[model samples]
Target: MQYDIEADWHLLNTCNYRCGYCFFTADTLGDKLQMHASPQQWQSAFDATDFTWLLHMTGGEPSIYPLFAELCEALTKRHFISMNSNLSRPLQSFVERVDPSRVSFINAGFHFEERERRSGNAVFLENARLLQSKGFPLLVSIVATPSALARFEEAADILAQAGIVPIPKILRGSYNGQRFPEAYTEPDRDRFRKFAALAQESYREMLNTSGHPSIDMFGDIHLLYGEPSFTGQLCEAGRRFVNIGPKGDVIRCGGPTVYGNVLAGTFKRAKRAKPCNTGGCIYFCQKYTSGPSGPQETRSGFFDWVADVIGTAKHPV
Candidate 1:
């Protein structure tokens, strides 16, 4: 199901877990949940655009959003959906209600150390396996912080019980007062490379056919070596990709250019790709823009399969 545009929709701030590495801390993701509109309203708003959208449902945790299953059901009726979730919500409703074909993929974050502290891995495992059984394109990953990498093997063994391995998601930004991918030690890097290779092999069939996971494991693996700069380049962000805030405020990529509110049915889209000056989500930069060097993603066979599956960073994004 190829789409005209892909939106990184920030659904809500409500979350169930408090992982130390999360950009949103416990205080930021507090207990209060907000639902801006009903499923039908959201569906109508997108319909008003007269565009077939591929919405990347994101949040502090999207599954925790009120009537999440209904939202997925309604949105996928005309548009497509991919999700980023913690696998903490009960998916019985989602699995039964939403169509697997309409779903591009699901990137389930397996927060190991946090789950261990709160004893949530069992539920995580159950949910992860359940989705796989339903034929949803799924990728389970662990953010490769020092503690998670140390505990990777044990976590991998646990996931192996369900016939899947958690990929090493490179830790970015700041953690424990240290900026990462760079903060990693030689031993840490070796371990990350090893697991990444194993995970790539484990998910070979999926990657080869469906697409790269919502979190690009290969791009992340490369980031462990060096950070690529794509500050100014010709990008398709505004035209083919956009960032949507929780209220449906549409911003081109992560830039300040307002495309109007999607929920308000006032979006004005770009007709063609343009040069981007902003910086955020390099996956989009690496994908939507063309450049000479740095983060050269070989879009052969499997990666070409990615274009068919999720398209470009129109947010693995």
Candidate 2:
């Protein structure tokens, strides 16, 4: 529930599934998986920072990372970890070796079409059930694309057979040569809302309290209407939360601000918040952007310094 810094770490891009709506292309997904460091090295780099970190590990499929269980095991020994995965890989090692308390959440992305094509529903459900049984905070979601929305009922039925209801993840990019959720018809929007509501009710406790940024169910709903811009808004992205690349380039949100590399032991945390210049993830934008401080702003005052941290970071993203 608490950590000094929460890193949005994009560990790798190799994946087993080729979901069309995914940002990664077939080549990117098929990219040969590689580990830039050992499990011990990654753990050591994180420990070098004097702060307790909540690492949000994501990828084309983080489960496919080399020595995944060992990496997670090592990291959780000193810091908390969260993840976004397709639930396709073996998880017995993860469930046994990693402590549930050291985990923030596991976003099980239910790629309905991909699972159906690969006949992987059984394994996916089995993994989800295992994680839930082990008391890990789990959230299941399905990307709401045109094809996905049309077959949502069938997908819901399939999930229902396993006692799972998936939240609808809105598409923010071009899908099948069409843009969406704009490309979605009114029927699509209506159907999406129904599932979104069901998903919200199922994980209300975690959704209301510590909604995972990767699967912000509420933010997904808001995105259903329209994407909001947060330019010039004061935000604490660099100071409290950071976006880390696969090779360990530390970025201040989606902007070009790089704070060295964590793996190379040169990363530095920003002293305070700054105005948001880049438009990126809607969850980060909405969570970190603050209400108007009004005009007549002066950064040289004591009140301004306190406001810099508390004004935007009081509510953890």
Candidate 3:
């Protein structure tokens, strides 16, 4: 029995589309970098810990990985397996390997920004339709841009007609240097609350394909680090979750620092240091403070893991 349960959402960098506002820098057009954990690498990660139940499998697009089905088979033996995808491929391919109950619904990243890319929406709808027909889980997740909210009614109608549920995500901009959105103001909050309530009531009759009846993975866990319930001044990434790259480099969490090659020694050489980068964490490393005036708090042990994981990021001057 594993002592502590940690959700390991691995990133196998195989992808298809190049979205403009991708969280991962390498997920852009110019930097076409793809790194996947080989069979040996995954074996090594599995051997490193005795986690009771493994979490889900995430990626740039899990379907793009040729060995995705094989990976699912191996994962089903030990953990609850789920994959996040853009729903650009055939559902039959995935059904051939994964079981419906064990798998969560697919998170269809709707390409609304690219209106001319008609196939984008078509493929997502097709995939959702196939999954729905087979009684498999299916969902639609869209990054709610300023433009999206303005046209939310039409979008919701389209998805509802296709027998899919839409999950609206709050899009936060780039890390450290980039500025946060100005539109996230008082009026927007009030409007959103009403919109969400109305949406829930209106779509109550629809059979949403995602995890939940409507939304699949709600809240900021996908963007923020740690569980929403985890609240404190620090986090325990090193002790809780170990993020290992293909080259055997261990980092506190998957963020900007990973590319810098901050090699903390292997898991066996776990040290006791504090992460200095805590002040400017870009990822959801901690929980969100509810009140406007409250000081933000994160999960426990975050600093301790960072201190032990690696050192400074040496950006080019």
What lDDT would each prediction earn against the true structure?
Answer: 0.80, 0.79, 0.49
Residues 200-257, candidate 2: write the lDDT tens digits.
7777776577644444654465455445456777877898788988888899878688
Per-model TM-score, in order, reads 0.90, 0.88, 0.64
Give the least accurate 10-residue stretch of model 2, judged by summed lDDT. 294-303
Writing each residue's lDDT as its tens digit, candidate 1 over 102-211 gives 99889899888888888887888899889989998888889999888998999999999888888898998889999986788978987888898888888888878876
Q: Is candidate 1 or candidate 3 better by lDDT?
A: 1
lDDT for model 3 comes to: 0.49
Strongest candidate by TM-score: 1
User: Ten-residue segment with the worst summed lDDT in candidate 3?
Assistant: 220-229
TM-score for predicted model 3 compared with the true structure = 0.64
Clashing pairs in 1: none
Report the Cα RMSD per candidate: 5.5, 6.6, 9.7
Report the C-alpha lDDT of model 3 over 146-258, residue by residue, as the tens digit: 56667766776767768555666655665344433434444544444445555444444443423132122242223222222222333444544435453445455543333
Best by lDDT: 1
